[model samples]
Target chain A: MLEARDLACLRGERVVFAGLSFRLEPGGALLLVGANGAGKSTLLRLLAGLLRPEAGALLWDGADALADRAAHAARIRYLSHQDALKPALTARENLHFFAQLWGGEVAAALDALDLLPLAELPARVLSSGQKRRLALARLGLSDPARRAPLWLLDEPTVGLDAASVGKLGALLARHRAAGGMVLAATHLPLPMPGAGELRL
Target chain B: MALLARELRLALRHPADTLAAVLFFVLVAALFPFGVGPAPETLARLAPGALLAAALLAALLPLDRLFGADAEDGTLDQLLLSGLAPPAVALAKAAAHWLTTGLPLLLATPVAAAMLNLPVEAWGAAMAALGLAAGFLSLLGTAGAALTLGARRGGVLLPLLVLPLAIPAVIFGAAGIEAAASGLEARPYLLLLAALLAAALPLAPLAAGAALRVE
Candidate 1:
């Protein structure tokens, strides 16, 4: 399980959010909804252990996430809005690179993302949606055996089309069914069954 | 090890950048004779300074892209979230920068040496000095790149931040060549370069890692 208690975030001199709290168990999905500048992305960063909370603790499986950072990191994967791809590299190369980092199956993940045909194409030639799809494919490639149970996605559906959204919904559902927890921050409504919503 | 492999693959995919730096080193070395007049004694005297300057410029040219792309595309954030220590990632990036830019420059110094009319006996000493100098510059450049991550005019700001730090490497490199040419031992200058690299190897990564966290 992942838990956030009394979470507070400050950007510059402005307080984005304070005293936020939530818990996500295995097989659970939580969608974070908020207005622009509501600190949704900041919250996601805190959950991913990319940013520290000002007045709270993020705990994973009863241990402080900061105390056992590597264990927590191995158990979670966070996908940000930017694709984080090197523009000069081919799709296959990018996947292969990240696959090596995460110790995943590169070929299978590319096949699953329908990126095989564009595998040799440099990411600079890919469209925005295509880049987003490629980034999502990284999540798939990160842990094929579903060992990383926590996924924090920030605006994952922003550039995805309806078809890709449906594909994502199915992927999230399968992930949840397999006892993985998902915390997605999105403006668009997700189609996952029994997914809880948290509006900031 | 994986980071090194990934960085190497990335470098291979963009051969233009590496090629450009090497070409620049040779081209800049070639220009020295034109500007200073081609007297053998004068050419030999100016050779070490010209080579050191060219090496420094070539090594610094691509540093902006070290963490710039990663920061812009959010890979830096993912890396921060990857559970790897910030210092480790910073070191990996520095190593990558050296492989792509520094290594090529080191390999190309022989050609640059010939272009600059460096004395035949000074070739080995010159190359040794440049190799150590490149390694030192690469580490400092990585830290500078990280420090200027999201600043306006970052590309312009990088050299300004890094060049002052590069002075020590240039001094030691040129001193080694001068020592070799003057029949003095080059060990002192070489030692200085190695010591600078040693200090930078640990400190640069820590500074770069802290900069990443701040961003």
Candidate 2:
């Protein structure tokens, strides 16, 4: 179980959010909803251990999660707005690099996003939506043998098409079926079903 | 090693950044002979300082983009969350910088020194001293790059931050070349250059890694 108690955040001199609390159980999915200036991205970053809370405690399985940051990080798969690709590298080479860093089957991950046909093309040549799909392909690269239990996604479906959205929905369903948890912040509809909503 | 391999692959595909730095190094050293009269003795006397200074400046040219590109593309965030220590990431960058930038500079050092009329006796010492100096510069550059990552006018700020710290490398490098030219022992100066590298090998990555984690 993941739990947050009275979390607060500060951006520059302004307070983004304060006195926030939530709980996420095993196999649970939480969708974050808020207006443009709301703290959805900040909350996802905090949960991913990218940003520190100004005040509050985060607990995982009834223990302090932030105390051992590397351990916490190992359990997370985060996808931000940017595609995070090298323009000079081919799509296959790009996915292979990440696979080498975090154990995964590269070909399978590429296939998951239907990227095998364009695998030889340099990322720079891919369209914006294709780049987003390529980024989503990373989600499938997590080793099923030792899957990262928690996924923190920020605007994951931004540039994807209708067909790509269906593929992503299947991926999310499989993750949840395997007892994984997802915390996503998005303005669009996601594939998650019966998910709890958190508004900022 | 994955990060290092990825960095090398990226560099190989473009090849422009590496080529630009080396060309700049040779060109800068070549300019010195023209600015000063081409008298052989004058060229010989000025070669050590001119060559070393040019190499140092050339190394500085690529430091601004060392971390800037990764930050802009969001690759840095993935690296931070990869579960590898941040120091290890910074170390890989330093290694790649040396391999692509420093190694090329060292390979071209003899040609630059030759053009400057440096004696054959000093060539070996110049290469040795420059090898050490280049590695030291890579480390210092990594730290400076990380510190100035998100700052305004970072390209302008990088040399201002790294050049002062690089004085020792030039001092020892030039002295080693001068010693060899005069038939004196150059080992002492070369060792000093190595010592500076030894000190920076551990400290620079640590500082750069800490800076990376701040955001």
Candidate 3:
């Protein structure tokens, strides 16, 4: 389980959000909704241990996760606006490189996102939606030992088509069913059951 | 180790970026004769300074792209969070930068040295100094590149930040070559270059890695 307490974020000189607190249990989903610049992304980054909050503690089952970032990062996948891909390499190569780095199941990641056909295509030629899916494919790269990993996704549905969106919803459902937890920031409504909803 | 291989692979995909730095190094060295009015006596006299300064400038040319490309594309952040030590990533990047840019400069130096009328005896010393200077510059440059990773006008800011740090290497390199030209021992200056390399090897990566961690 992941937990945030009395969280606060300051971007530049402005306070984006403050006094935010939440808990995510096994098989749970937390949906964050906000207008543009409402600090949804900021909060997710904090949860992913990407951004340090001005005031708060991120606890993993009562212990501070911040104190051990490498171990924490190994358990979570943070998907943001950028896909972290090389345009010159094909999709498979990109995924393969990440798997080598992160210890993921590459073939299943592609299958989960239905990206096998586009696997050999260079990322430069991929459409925006395809690129987004490719990024989503990373979530599938989790190791078999950790079938129920945490996902920190920011606007993950931005350019996804309807069919891809369904695939995403299904992926989430399956993941949550297996005791995985998700903390997502999105404007699009998703079919997530029994999810904790928060508006920043 | 994996990160270093990945960096090399990415660099391999963009051969043009690596070649551009080498071409710039050669072209700039080639122009020294015309700019300084090609008299062999004067060229030999000016060769040490010319070679060192040109190599310094050429090394600076690629520093901007060192972190800019990865930062823009978001791979830098992923690398930082990839469970490898941040310092390890920074060091791997420095290794790749040195291999692609610095090695080429070393290879081109012999021809440039000949063209500039450097004494035959000084050629070996010059190459040694330059080889050390290349490693030193790559080490120092990676820190500057990491410091300016996501800033606006990073290209313009890089040289201003790095050149001051490079003066020691420049001095030792040029002075060493000049010493060899006069039949003097260049060992002292070469030792200083090695010391600089030693100091920079451990520290540069730590500094660059810290800069990369700034969120």
Q: Give the top-scoring candidate (TM-score).
A: 2
Q: By descending TM-score, how would the candidates be arranged?
A: 2, 3, 1
For all candidates, state DockQ relative to the true structure.
0.65, 0.82, 0.67
Candidate 2 collision pairs: none
Cα lDDT, model 1, residue B100: 88
Measured over all alpha carbons after superposition, the RMSD of each candidate to the real structure, in angstroms, is: 2.2, 1.0, 1.7
For residue B20, give model 3's deviation from the true position in Å: 1.2
Worst 10 residues of 1 chain B by lDDT: B78-87
lDDT of 2 by residue, A1-200 (tens): 89999999999999999999999988899999999989998888898888999999999998999998899988989998788999999999989988987889988998888899999999999999999989989988877687898999999899889899999988899989889999999999998998999999
Query: Per-residue alpha-carbon lDDT of model 3 for B1-215, expressed as tens digits?
Result: 87777778888988987788878877877898898898999999999888888887887887898888887777876776677888888899889888888888888888889889999999999989988998998998999999987788888898899889889998999999999999999999999999999999999999998888874
RMSD of model 2 against the true structure: 1.0
| Residue B89 Cα positional deviation in candidate 3, in Å, after optimal superposition | 1.2
Better of 1 and 3 by TM-score: 3
Docking quality tier of model 3: medium
Give lDDT tens digits, candidate 1, residues B103-161: 88888988988877787788889989998999888889888999998899999999999
At residue A75, candidate 2 shows an lDDT of 90
Give me the runs in candidate 1 sitting further than 4 Å from their true place. A142-146
- Per-residue C-alpha lDDT of model 3 across residues A76-98, encoded as one tens digit per residue: 88887788888998899889888
Give the least accurate 10-residue stretch of model 1 chain A, judged by summed lDDT. Answer: A138-147
Kindly report which residue stretches of model 2 are placed more than 4 angstroms away from their true locations once superposed.
none
What's the TM-score of every candidate structure? Answer: 0.92, 0.98, 0.95
